[model samples]
Target: MRQNLSVEEALEAILEGARPIAELEPLPLAQAYGRTLGAELSARVSHPAADDTAVDGYACREADTRGASPENPVRLRVVGLAPAGQPFSQEVGPGQAVQVFTGAPIPLGADAVVRVEDTRREGEFVWLLRPASPADIRRRGEDLVEGQTYLHKGDLLTPARVGLAAAMGHPVLPVVRRPRVGLLTTGDEVVEPGEPLPYGGVYNANSYTVAGLVEEAGGEPVFLGKAPDSPEELRTHLAQTQGLDLLVTTGGVSMGERDVVRKLLEAEGQIHFWRVRIQPGGPLLWATWNGLPLLGLPGNPVSAMVSFLLFGRPLLFRLLGRSDPPYQQLRAVAETRFEANPARRAYRRGILRWAGGYRVASTGSQSSVVLRSMAVGNALVVVEAGKPVRAGEEVEVIPLPGGKTAG
Candidate 1:
């Protein structure tokens, strides 16, 4: 097991063993949102399969209404009406026009459309105030081309992509199955929310936070309940998750006497790496137990959450086969001075503001125990090891989930 590894080194090691599943499933377009595409998607049919009108108008040959104004209107015989989904079967003649509504396919011989507001109907005669141009007609295959690949493999099925698939006449899409992850929060001092807490015990917030994060990253989280700091109880809980793709445990990763998670994993599982050089979340442990990926996070609420954001979330996205996850790193100027750790990198919770440029201000108190600072923060201002930054100094920030940032 490698101890005291750099953040990049640990991440490289962790991902070396993580591989995306090969199984694919077909899902309906409406149910595929947030799922990763397992296969590239191509349009089966062209959007607007035929040339159509952009507005309710008179579809006629441009030469038929060459020069006409309000004072000297051109009169053309209205032969037929074409509404949406129905087209005039007859070809437009030299002195005749087809009345077409918006989205109606243009008649066979028509080359232009004059807006309805520009013409008036008198029984069988339609008056044109001005000449029309061919540009008013929407050409066939204007939105999507048949046999063209619009969505690539590993792309997340967003609402826009879903709409595109449907527009191209695809009712179903191939997508990767969501990864199943087992969440276990260990330690006797932790109690589930809504349960009466005994003396010296605190409510377990990491379970819910980790569960929500897992779901947001396209993984299904299965709560395995809290495990006491005992080798037998921890082993029993770990044994019950034989079908999960990954196991994430909070607490019992540090060098404390009660840290049974690491102790148990070391005795049974293969430890890949531990102790990343990061403040507030340095004691991160990565291991594999019976061919299952296991991640052990620190006991502190902020540390566990930050560790998951930096590492666990990306791993889940990888398992889902997403080439690009939603988590992003951007540059911002520090609004206030911040001290850095002498030997470890720090991720300080803060709110990002955009005035003339992106600016980040620290949420009060950077203690790992204070989860509220993380609750109100929109970004994690990254400070390199041994490099303190002053006000107005530029730094890298990782945007948190669902938080709005400056443009």
Candidate 2:
């Protein structure tokens, strides 16, 4: 097993064996929001199927409106009316005109449209104050062409894309199925929330936190409940993940005497890596058991959450057939001094604000067990190993989700 790997090296090892789900399902346009497209979608029909009028006016031959102006207007007999979706069956001759509303199909033999503002109507006759032009007509298939592929495979179905699909005559869309991820929290000191807390016991925050992160990454999280630090109990809980694509466990991955998860995996499953060179989340583990991929995260609240953001989220995206980067990085000036860790890369929680430029300040103590630090922080300041940053120095920063608002 590879031990003490860098952040990038461990991620490479974890995703080398990852594969996107193959199953595809058809969903109604309304329910397919945020889902990935399973196959290429082509337009079933053309928009504006025929030459249509773009304004409320009269459809007449351009020759009939020649030399027409307010000083010497041309008058033509109004023969018929053409509203939207209804066509005027008769041909518009040189001395005749057809009243056309917006989106109405232009009458046969009419090559120009004169806006209503440029004409004066008097009962059966209408006067053309200005010469009409053919530019006022919208040609057939102007917006969308028949059989044209507008949405490609692996495309994300956003709101505008959904509307475009509807306009292309699709009532439903073929979308890739969401990956199912199994979450298991192991530790005797952890108990479910709302349950009476025993002495020196803590609530099971990892389950809910990891579950939420899974959902945000476009995966369905299946809770496997909490398991005490025992080989038998862990095996029983693991057996529940028969059809799951991935398994994630919090705690029991370090070298503590009670850390039985690693021992069991080493004896049964294939271990790919053991630890990462990252502060607050160094005890990371990746393995495969009976053909199922398992990712073990640290036990601390902050460590589990941050490690998932960096590693687990990308794995979920790969399974969904997406190529989005794990996080958005930028350079920001430091508002306060940031201490350095000589041994491992550190992800320090901080708050970012826009003041002519992005300025970041630490969010107090950077302890692994402090969950409040993540709550109050809007960004993560990356401090490279053995690099200490002073105030006013530029540093690498990754803005947290939904924290891009300007100060």
Candidate 3:
């Protein structure tokens, strides 16, 4: 198995083996928001199927209103009124006009529309004081054309896109099925939240954190419960992932004697790589068991969360048929001094802001066990090994999911 791989190398290895889910299901346009499109969608019909009036006005021939003014008005007989969704059936002759409301189809043989405010009506007779123009009409198929493809496969259905599909005469949309991910946490020191906490025991924070990350990446997380550091228990828990698309486990991946997860993968599963060259999350592992993709994360709270963001999130996106980048990186100037680790790359949590230009400052401590650091920070500043960064130096920063920068 490969060991001590760079962050990019490890990500490439994981994504190289990923396959998008093939199952598809149709969902109503209202419920298909945020889902990936499974097929190309074309418009079924044209918008404004006929030439319609854009304002409340009178439809009349332009020649009839020529030289019309307040001093010398043109008088025409108002034969009929056409409201929205109803068209005037009869033709409008040179001496006649039709009262047309907004969105009403223009009457036959009428080429111009004069605003109601520009005319006076009395006893079926209308007087035009100004000449009318054809610009007041909305031509047929102006907004959307029939059979035109507006959305393609693998496109994310956002709110505006959903409305577009609806306007295209689609009541439902075909979308890729959400991948089911099995999540498991190991360690005798971990216990379920809300239960009585014994001395030296901690709550299972990794499960919720990783599960939330999976959900945010368009995957359905199935909790496999916590497992002790025993081989028998871990194996039994692993067997529960029969129909799942992916499996993720936290803890028991390091070289400690109680790391039964790594031992089990070594014996039965195919190990692609172990131990990435990253600080706080160096014990990352990737493997496969019984033809299922598996990703093992470190036991620390911060480590598990960071590893999932950098690695697991991208895998989920691939399965969902999305081409989004794994993480967004930007250049920012350091607001404070940042210490460097000599052996491995460091990902220091920090607050990112925009003041004239991008600026970042560390969030106090960089300890792996300090979960509060992630809660208060919106970005991660990457520092190369053996390189210390001073204030005012430009550094590489990755903005976290759902994080917004202060301006």
Candidate 4:
């Protein structure tokens, strides 16, 4: 095997070259928070039916308030008060106005609004400071026109976007259901968590961690327990499980002698090695078997995690028909002095952030076996392959795998 491939070459081997919607059922919007979209969603209605008061003020005709100044203001009697969720009783005529609160529907024949701060109240009479025009009012359908599309098809259902759909009066939405992800971990030296560990056996962290990551990436994870080192048992266990959108296997993907998953699924799909030029996740294997994504991950906990983030995460979004899930790669200004070796690009785990207009990252270590570093890190510091990046150099950093955004 070659040492490492460029990021593009690695990605090419992993991806199927075309994106298609995965097999999934339609789920109600209430239970579809993290689910990927299956199809496009259309707007139900326009934003507002009429001109609305964005602020709490009085609505009146601007022409009626002409000649009104700070010194000698025009006084108009407040005829009615309109609050949100209710209609205004009377329209503003000459020398008359309606007191409206925020989000209240503007009364008919009202042109402009005068804030309460610029007015003096004397019983039912309020004074205006300056001349107001009808042009000062928000026009009809200003926020959104009727039947306009706020969100198009194949869009992810982010919380804000969901709220936007709700604002458009859509109670239920048509979104793609989350695909079921079957997780399997293989290693004779792995033990279940909360169990007494025998010598040379460690607690199984990849299964749970990967399951959590799957759920976070909008996929339903099905734990297939643990598979032993035998190839027959692994093949039988995996072959029996059906209707899965993806099957993820960790701890048996590397070239180690105990690695058996690659050979077990050899006939089902063509295996391709991806030397994803990133440290801790350099070795990657991908294929499609029986209309399902088969991703064989590295044995090291850190390596498995990085592979899932860089490749598996985006694949889930694409399968669910989310054109661009919330995976933003932002460049934080350099704040600390750090160096990298000339090899694979390193995805340094640390608390990456911007403070005083500089990027700061501090990870405990870059070892592929450390889970403590991943626990405390919020982002990845990207170092280019085959080169060293000095402090203050701008490097692309992908955000920690959370949220519904895209990369």
Best candidate, lDDT-wise?
3
TM-score of each: 0.96, 0.86, 0.88, 0.87
Name model 4 segments beyond 4 Å from true. Answer: 1-5, 22-32, 89-91, 132-136, 267-269, 274-277, 288-291, 332-343, 403-407
1-407 in candidate 3: lDDT tens per residue?
99999999999999997888989999999899988888999999998888999999899999989998899999999999999988899999979999999999999999999999999889989999898779999999998899999988888888999999999999999999999999999999999999999999999999999999898878899999999999999999998998899999999999999999999999999999999999879999999999999999999999999999999999988998885676799999999988888988999899999999999999999999999999899999999999978899999999998888988
Please give, for residues 90-195, the per-residue lDDT of candidate 1 as tens digits.
Answer: 9998989999998999998899998888898899999999887688889999999999999988998889989998998889998998899999999999988899
Our tally of clashes for model 2 stands at 0
Model 4, span 1-407: residue lDDT tens? 33356766766555656365555565555665655555455556655667777777789888778889999999888889998878696667787899888778889878788877778888999889877545445666676666777776567677777777677776766666677799988888889988999999989999988999898877889999888998877877788559887889887766666678766556555666634567877767776656667887887998898889888887777666776853677877554544564777777775675565436465767788998877877777777766555667766677687522211
Model 2 / residue 207 / CA error / Å: 1.3
Better of 1 and 3 by TM-score: 1
Best by TM-score: 1
Task: Give me the displacement of residue 232 in model 1, in angstroms.
Answer: 0.9
Candidate 2 residue pairs in backbone clash:
none
Error of 2 at 30 (Å): 1.9
Candidate 3 or 2, higher lDDT: 3
Model 4, residue 226: displacement in angstroms?
A: 0.6
Predictions: Cα RMSD each: 1.5, 3.2, 3.0, 3.5
